[model samples]
Target: MTKSENTLIRLEAALERILAGEPKRIPKNRKLSIRAVEEEANLGNGSCHYYSEFSSKVRILKSKQRSSSSQQEADTGFTDFLKSKAANEKRIKEKYRSENVELKKTIQQLAAEHHLFNELIRRLKTQSKQLEVENKELNVALENTRDELTQLKRERIFKLNKK
Candidate 1:
């Protein structure tokens, strides 16, 4: 046989082996594809694309496999499990998203409250300093008044003794 004929034959055998899940050159249970077939046949990449008829056949076989597998999954109730799992995941994602939004609002409120408290503390400190200055002034004035009273009392006592 010609080299082209030999290549076509190898390609056909590879395609069958892959579809039957009995690949020799490649690992078993690999997904069916032109590249997989090429590897299974020990042929170079893009070898199968040169033959349009083979490419079409591969497409038809892959579609059939997909349909059959999907039907089997439905029969085994696996499709239902996957659907429920996906729904649960979606619900959990939405719950977390809403919680994240609430947490952000709480953080914003706390930040505002923190700013208010800091401002109040600053005002209190200023008032305390003013009060301290006023207290010191009052103490100095009271000491001067006591000294004047003592001098007046001494002058009165001396005047009475001389009389």
Candidate 2:
């Protein structure tokens, strides 16, 4: 039987024994075993232990429900955060793809420009060699012309001295 039922039996037995001329004193220090119920007879200090214990149980249940609801909201938020992160990652990947295409084009253009610069350098070196050869030829021609002019001046001086 439950504790309350047992208490009821104990009280009844105590009362029966008193009626049988056995007036034994009930122990004042006997703490009554209570379940989840308000024992108003034991209502002291403006609160019942059983009532407070019941209220605390109720508060705990309510708090659990509140926590469960809040956790559901957090789960929704986490899903949204994951979705946003996926969208952002997709956007970044698209950006990188486009940038990679542009970079490839730039690399191709730079390679072409590099080839043109190498060709220009080769042509410049070829032209420089041709100029050097032409310079040497011009120097030899100038020496020949100076020698002929000197010979002509020498003949003129000899003829003039003869006159």
Candidate 3:
């Protein structure tokens, strides 16, 4: 129809294309500004200010974009929270696994030490029994020798008295 109307249509189309490509590369909650739309449309400076309809259309588009972007930001924030939570859980599980492995090694080492100590105790008990037997035999021999000495002293006294 008119030249200005044709230019406005081009601006709208450019804005639509920019928004369409937003999910791939754009940051969260980003709305197109008048300057940005104008640049995409290849329009000269202050062209939007010159157009009364341009201002209203840009306002409506910005409002609609803002509402949708708010929802998108909320969804992205929730997704980020979930990812962080999962990562934290994974770290905790790994730490517990590492601690469990260390505990198992400690238990195994203690078991080995216990076995060694038990064998040492058994050997000591056997040695103690052998020593006890030897001590009893020595005590019996000493008693027999003491009795023989007493008998010899008695005989010596009796011969002296007779003389």
Candidate 4:
């Protein structure tokens, strides 16, 4: 009938969506906070604070939701609760087990790459040392060639002067 009424209805719907794990505007894993409700309802931030009554109602709903699962279990029976809990734990255990296997594969791949790189480095170092030795021997040969050329020039000059 009024703007306030419309906003309140929207907020209530958003809270229901969140509680039912079917939120539209906000993420499913978002906690039951005023801000989350506001976002879920597509309202501005702190909109809930504008209505004190609505804010209090939201708080109450949050507290109830926290213990709702246990309350449901109590209403039903311990057997059902235990079965559900065991199933949940089994799922979690399997998730972690698969993750561990993937991590071990990644580590093995990395180790193999490291070993290959180390071998490459060793071969490169050996080639580098061999090149250095060859370079030094070439330099010595160059110096010897220069000395012989200088002697030959001096002898030619002495013969020309005598002529």
Candidate 5:
């Protein structure tokens, strides 16, 4: 089944069980379980107007099932619970914001380190090319010196034979 259907099924089953053997009917203060289900379905905050209406209907159904004498108590309990839940939600949001800021800082640091590493690699490659050119020049100079030494030896031999 689809995700929403699955959540609705679970909500219905839990509601049935909570109300099953109650002496004075199900308590009207069931908003917590209802909201918990919404959160589980990933629709707690961003639901459309229809979701609000649906929740109201379920709440009314719960209220009607309760004893008339207990209505005032149930209403008070629901309001108090809502206040505490609102505070809890605020704290959660703040925590998430702090974590997000830390993550962004870490990502920025990693990017900078990667850029530095790339620059180091480029400089090493350039230096290697320069060293190769210098080595080739030295080899050429050594060969020229060898040729000049050979020519001088031949000239000295000719002078000694003429004497």
Candidate 6:
């Protein structure tokens, strides 16, 4: 057979092997690179690059794989985004929980301060009332002393007039 005919036969056989799941005839990783095709066809390393028909066929196969691969990549990206979002939400929730705990503690402290201030005011009011009572008693004693002094002075003046 002519060299071109031989190449065509090898290329057809390679395509059949790829479709038939022949081990090592196709890449195990599901990537149909040009190298894999050339190896399957038992062609020289650069043979497929030289043949326009072979190159076009490789392009067609790769495009087909890419269409399906693109969908899978999109799904993976969405899944990663969801995972990140969930983690961020959890972090925010924990932060808020800690802040809430601190706020509750602060409120308790303020309540204690308020109670102490109220107690102090009550004690001051009681002291003020006691002072008022003492002032009233002192005023009464002073009035009694003044009356006694005036009586003594009148008695002395009457005795002197009699003498």
lDDT score, candidate 3:
0.82
Task: Residues 96-160, candidate 3: write the lDDT tens digits.
Answer: 99999999999999999999999999999999999999999989999999999999999999999
The worst-scoring run of ten residues by lDDT in candidate 6 lies at 23-32
TM-score of each: 0.49, 0.62, 0.56, 0.45, 0.41, 0.62
Which residue segments of model 6 deviate by more than 4 Å?
1-6, 16-27, 49-51, 132-163
Q: Give all candidate RMSDs, comma-separated.
A: 11.4, 14.8, 5.9, 19.4, 20.5, 4.9
Worst 10 residues of 3 by lDDT: 22-31
lDDT comparison, 3 vs 5, better candidate: 3
Q: With candidate 4 superimposed using the best TM-score fit, by how many Å does residue 155's alpha carbon deviate from the native?
A: 4.0
Per lDDT, the best of the predicted structures is: 4
Q: Write the per-residue lDDT of candidate 4 for residues 67-141, one digit (tens) a residue.
A: 896688687888787889999999999999999999999999999999999999999999999999999999999
Worst 10 residues of 4 by lDDT: 66-75
Clashes of 6: 0
Residues 19-131 of candidate 1 have per-residue lDDT tens digits of 77788999997878888889988999998898999989988888888899889978779768888999999999999999999999999999999999999999999999999
How far in Å is the alpha carbon of 19 misplaced in model 6?
6.3
Candidate 4 CA-lDDT value: 0.91
The sequence of per-residue lDDT tens digits that candidate 2 reaches over residues 1-163 is: 9865554454445434433445345333332222211232222332334345444654564467568878999999999999999999999999999999999999999999999999999999999999999999999999999999999999999999999
Q: Deviation in angstroms for 39 in model 2?
A: 24
Tell me which residue pairs clash in candidate 5: none
Off by over 4 Å in 2: 1-54
lDDT of each: 0.90, 0.65, 0.82, 0.91, 0.67, 0.82
